[model samples]
Target: MVTPRLRHPVRRIGDRDIDFSRRLAVMAIVNRTPDSFYDRGATFALEAAVASGRAAFEAGADVVDVGGVKFAPGPPVPVAEEIDRVVPVVRALAPFGPVSVDTFQPEVARAAIDAGAAVINDTTGVHDPRIADVVADSDATLVVAHSLAAPRTQLPLPHYDDVVAEVRDFLEHRVAVAREHGVPAERIIVDPGHDLNKNTRHSLELTRRLGEFADIGLPMLVALSNKDFIGEALGRDRDQRLHGSLAAAVFCATQGARMVRVHNVRETVDALRMVEAILGWREPAYLLHNMRSEGNE
Candidate 1:
């Protein structure tokens, strides 16, 4: 039970074979939604979104998660419009490296895949099994994130008897659905859907017990960047939540989370690198502190 929780040593997302045994992946967010709670549509324009992806890749982001729809309640974006919003960014960024589309609609997932997205990041936990079928038909990865609300709908005062147990169980059920749809085991990832229809206490409990998710036997992706829970935890606004976010991210990574979805790509990459070094999974870039025969001090 104390062994590495991830069943697969390598998870092939997009064109990369992520070594889950040693590295923590950073899934950088580049939202194309004008009303995104994080960036406030900073990358809503096609060019801005593409530029953001490129910048994230340069900053050491392992995967670029391109989202066209805002997570909070919003006006409905027609399927075609959503496709129009994400497909181009997916196409532009796909060549650079692994590109994930944050969507739940089967049609949008199919379109994004056709446009070169390698991961269908369904934060809805694949409420519609057709999304699983779409992923199955392709060689793409699927992220089944646990969330109770329908896409763009609100779940007022969401409650759970035990958030961790319920979230883990939800993910297990969703993974089974994906498997039933022929999605290979190595291509499936799970996210606990922090702050998505969950209150801060629930999110914190999920974070505290995130290790329990290892029972699911798959790589875990924690999308806890700049979330309301972090803000509520430390009383910081979106832009000010970086420190709290890093703390949560590092804790989860140390506890065996394989991927962290975040807006602060470079910071996350740097922080996770330090964690990896401390965990013996990575080496220091330069060992200059005490290499000399005599101490400089």
Candidate 2:
């Protein structure tokens, strides 16, 4: 007979202790580019992009990550051009809720922070020194995502002696860098960068073993929404991976992800609530009904 594992109690973020036990936070992706792999041409217009951000917030997203460049296998945009593309959107969306700027360039990071973005979602993990200075000078939280190689180079074939250990090490190194730059330890979040430089197997292993990164002691953000690995796993295309994306979100929440960046917010939120119910991490309706019956008695 197999014993059921006990669910770990959800904890607060940073020393600030922000309670996240109510539900898994949803981060909606608002791509402000014409070349994004999944949502290309979907958010090209500024009005459409802002509307998408507003709609995502209405759909129960806790945060919105706005990006200017595609970052898919393509030519890189210049720093000035990237900033020009994202700052306006960030300025427009800052009043809604927590806004995150998705860029690795320091100039863009600084401009976005000035434009009222509360978080810096750096895909390159502060590879550029100026990015460190930008975060150090501001109150913005930094999300250091792990990408093995540049997207232009075909993802380096997912070579890893141990995927979990290498990813943990990379994140730990990034944390140390942020600390050295006067960015408080609690303000840092780590992401495994699913599908960024990883193949299907690497992404799967990372998803299954996400619990390992909890030892790093910072909030974990998982972006497995409609990624190609899900398509590969389900033998479906990007648009058809909705169910798979929700499944991955539930798995991430079970494995201790604090925030899930997804394109489909409502479905992911519902799936995570169900997972929480099954793990006894959340109060079950039947239990509540029984309590009401006993009260009547």
Candidate 3:
């Protein structure tokens, strides 16, 4: 099913206002950690992270999500280190576009917001509640993602009676909590946490049924960027899953997912634009190529 078109899904994040109804936005992944499952610390250094952020924005990222630690099982990083890892990068990237700090720690989130982050893309779905408080105190946006366990912990066997329904319920509850804590409804986004604690089958189900999440009424953000679920389904590795990831991304967008958090900014941006153009939400950049000109044709 095609996404029911929205009239005005415009919302501001940090310094920019995005019209989510008309244009699909890509949130580029800029990992500051040395052990992120996908990037493997390629941008862990401060200079590298800043450069990557710039490049992603240049490549058409509507936002940059900077994370100090990977979500998969890993050694615990101290709060100070987390702050150090993300703040500089956030500051460096603030002038480029909206910056989102991918952290659940209230302290680190606060630091990033102070340093010019417009959004806190917490994966815990406000598990601590204080993280919601941090976002409530700021004029920034909050991304509530559903996850079953603490960050970096080995995800236990997932047991959802109805994965899509359960994820929608969890995100609804978290969005309500965020509103109660003073974060405006317009500034909140929801994610179903694909592959966070789910196996391949569950993730696939969620992707197929993603349209159900529109009931949440907030903009939907899907992290389908070379995730394990895609790789598992295609018998591919992380490096070989770009094609699968793009396919999933287009599926999600068609189902009303307004935002995609991805590693390949340029490719995802192009795919989303093409999808939007086909949907009549956006126009092609040029019409001359297909036109039968009087002299050229």
Predictions in order: lDDT = 0.90, 0.79, 0.89
Question: Residue-wise lDDT of candidate 3 within 1-297, one digit each (tens)?
Answer: 455344337888877788887879999999998888898889999999999999999999999999998888877899999999999998899998999999989999899999999999989898878888988998999999999887779878889899998998889898888888888888888899999999999999999988887666788899989998999999998899999999999999989899999999999999999998988988789887668867877
TM-score of 2: 0.87
Ranking by TM-score: 1, 3, 2
TM-score of each: 0.96, 0.87, 0.96
Ranking by lDDT: 1, 3, 2
**Residue-by-residue lDDT tens digits, candidate 1, 120-211:** 99989989999999999998999999999888899999999999988888888889999999998888999999999999999999998887
Question: Tens digits of per-residue lDDT for model 2 on 19-122?
Answer: 34445677899999887878877997899899999999888777899989866667878889888888988888888777888998888899999998888898
Which pairs of residues collide in candidate 3? none
Candidate 1 error regions (>4 Å): 1-4, 295-297
The per-prediction CA RMSD against the true structure, in angstroms, equals 1.7, 4.3, 1.5
Off by over 4 Å in 3: 4-8, 295-297
What TM-score does model 1 achieve against the real structure? Answer: 0.96
